[model samples]
Target: MPRSKRVTIADIARLAGVSPGAVSFALNGRPGVSEETRQRILAIADQHEWRPSSTARALVGSRAGVVGFAVNRPARTLGTEAFFTDLIAGVQSSLAQHRIGLQLVVVPDIGEEVDTYRRWRRSNQVDGVLMLDPRVDDPRPALLRSLALPGIVLGGSPSGPDDSATIWLDDAQAAHTVFDYLVGLGHRHIVYLSGPAEFEHVRLRSEVLAGLAERGVTGETIITDYSPTEVATTMRTLLSRQDRPTAIVFDNDVMAIAGLRVSQEMGVAVPTQLSLASFDDSVVTGLMHPSITCLTRDTFGFGEKAAEYLLDVIASEERLPDRTGPRPHLTVRESTAPPPA
Candidate 1:
């Protein structure tokens, strides 16, 4: 047979001297076919190098053996962000176990992300999706529900009536852990450098700073684009302040590293005059001169669990309860200590 030519169930059935229904039953692991007949049909299928076509699977409302994952962020950022890279690797690991394909895409913004989902559903492009970075009044959840699409929210709580399940991290609790650690070190004033305020996780972490006054701790949260240059600039301004914060917490490891460089340039000694920490950690965190303190969690496991949960939702065809993943823990390092007396 010409390699360009396609093989179908009928072709396999004819070659195996069996009916097409028997071929279907054997291929799908149904009980209608005898064991001997099933083995013969399988041998023919293997000989022809036959595989189910995605188009045919979609048309028949069967498993496409694929899922969609979209990120509404700049492509350049994804390249430098270890968090996403680890998460994606974890997702791939779980998907590989079941031999499922992952369709990954990066869109300019949320609007385009929604458009992509709509198109995918209309064309039966995927059996499900994994949603990330939930925003205020996010339209993706309700849209997924309306389209009768199964999905899993990666980091935020689901809004509106959606059959989608959620895998969430306790951002507020993590923030408190950082605060307690810093405050216990006699750092009365702290600064929180965060990502865009629109992100639900960022908002949760920011909100925790509002109540710090009750404990005689002065706190300030500065929102930024999470770029190195921006973080450096913010650090310059903060370091120049008459009453600079004794400790600073960053939403990501990249920003913390940038802030550390700025501190060094300003003749400030880390953990002696200033301290730095990050909400997320990576191998880079440990490689730094002072080995910056940070909150550590299994980002890869997060993605793996997400893939498993979303697959389950698709298979069950029902809404499931939200799942809370492991909370990040503070890993103290050379970057944090008691404020200089």
Candidate 2:
């Protein structure tokens, strides 16, 4: 079959028997065109694979066609964590569909992250931003709002400004799931190895563990940098104690894997002597010895949804409601079992 000419809005209007203005209104999702006419115009546009050129979009005030994501984490830690890698792939995948690019930056700390956002806004380097690792009393939301820049927060509520929308998982419920599973396995002494304490999700998970005190199940939390070295040291330190926990939960798959290695070096057997579980499920967790039990969610899909929301916010002046992404489900594998007799 002969290929169709590069479809244009005028071609869509001519096919749908509507004015070009009507086609524009319908395609942009603005009011003015009747719903019936809007549907017809959309159908014609879809049939022809019509997409506006970046030049056309720029005439309508579109910026550099780029989005920003800044992370305040050490390069070593970021390099090892599969979650960031998978999440970035997903975000890029979604943005690429619309010809939008991502401007990712790694900063040394929160202060640097704030400065990066400021620079991006002032220089018009990015049309919008995607925020992660939300903290209690976070400054990013307010900073973005003050700059009048569009942004979407991932993994928690917007504490600083309502100008930004949020795409979050039910972290509290996920924490409960992990705790409940461990308790059911007859583990009383448990420990949670958490990422940075400032992260809202980490705090939420910590709260869930603390709440289990009423059930005669005690819990302790050790904050780490989510690096292999920190995780290994933390695991070794905890395991060397006389009252070492019979079960341990880690924040991410990398730390869980590191902890597993520490267990081997210290001559501690998994599942038999110590039950291990991690928060984020990844391929490494599944392939590792004793297959780590974990709370599994589509981190890649999470990134995609977050990027989609940010794009919508950037395109429209309307306020979108905060959305909850898919909940994390617990997947049991060989890493967790009942406490040793």
Candidate 3:
């Protein structure tokens, strides 16, 4: 068999119509080449499956221009999440400007999420990472520090004022805003259908509601694990029982949609029958029949910030990384209204 031609920088440079040095800088994600030229070279490299050679590695090293994302969400949720799709889009959008690739790897299960990061850090497989679905008192941030890994935490630990780059979303405030809206709408009894138990933000959202009840709010709450297929059954149980919640706030879009289905099945009228709101207002919210009232967050922006921060962590040496977005709040739709008399 005739040996396939070895892929080389010259092949890339010739195809991209740039000098070999420019190709090197472009492929390395180094400064000096314009973003336009960098993209051009990358496209040509992709066409040929061209990778940096050992000689190139000897000079520049085998750093793949790829960012890994480790998410704790279940395969079912991850497969359907508009937030993941949009977030990944934003990250890819930002990284593509520099010819960086995105390597999205879902942990086999929640247990594997943290271990994925640990293994990646040890292997030096990615240029950086985007960590999502944070857990309270998460050890990953400290792990990153201990390993001197370069990356960004999305909506997790506040990247220390002196710590590594991290994006901390005010998850408590987001839940509070949505709940307060429902409360003002006369939803005294509220049910919070939460995400996986280990997620920190899910816990925080639940905690905020729990604390609100202690403050003399006229509301009752129930918490449960999330799965779309089972929600109809759960909601039926909740509906049949006395003292059922008048309003529901979901920690995710999937649960909110599930709640809607359950309400329909039990002949419970939306708005008139039950009020609803959820966080992470992605396509599911907008596309649903009643158009779920939900917390308005810039998920795409979150991904962008996560990517930018990771880049900074890899490049910058000064100041705690900071980026801001509009605070997430309630985007009322037809799904929520005062309970029927």
**Residue range 133-212, candidate 1, lDDT tens digits:** 88766788888877777888887444344435788887778888988899988989999999888888888777787788
Compared with the true structure, model 2 gives a TM-score of 0.80
Candidate 3 ranges beyond 4 A from true positions: 1-62, 156-164, 218-223
**TM-scores, each model vs. reference:** 0.81, 0.80, 0.77
Better of 2 and 3 by lDDT: 2
In model 1, the worst 10-residue window by lDDT is 156-165
User: Which parts of model 1 have CA positions greater than 4 angstroms off?
Assistant: 1-61, 156-163
lDDT for each candidate structure: 0.85, 0.85, 0.73
1 or 3, greater by lDDT: 1
What are the per-model numbers of colliding residue pairs?
0, 0, 0
Worst 10 residues of 2 by lDDT: 155-164
> Which pairs of residues collide in model 1?
none
- After TM-score superposition, the amount by which residue 306's alpha carbon in candidate 2 deviates from its true location, in angstroms, is 0.8
Query: In candidate 3, what are the lDDT values of residues 1-341, reduced to their tens digit?
Result: 12287778787788778898998787665798999997787667655656445574556465767788876656677667677788888888888988888878767664576556554553345767777766666677676666566767676335555344667778777778888887777666787877666777777777778777765565444556667766667788889988778888876787888889889888888878888788868766888888999888787877777787788777766545556544677788889889877
Error of 2 at 249 (Å): 0.4
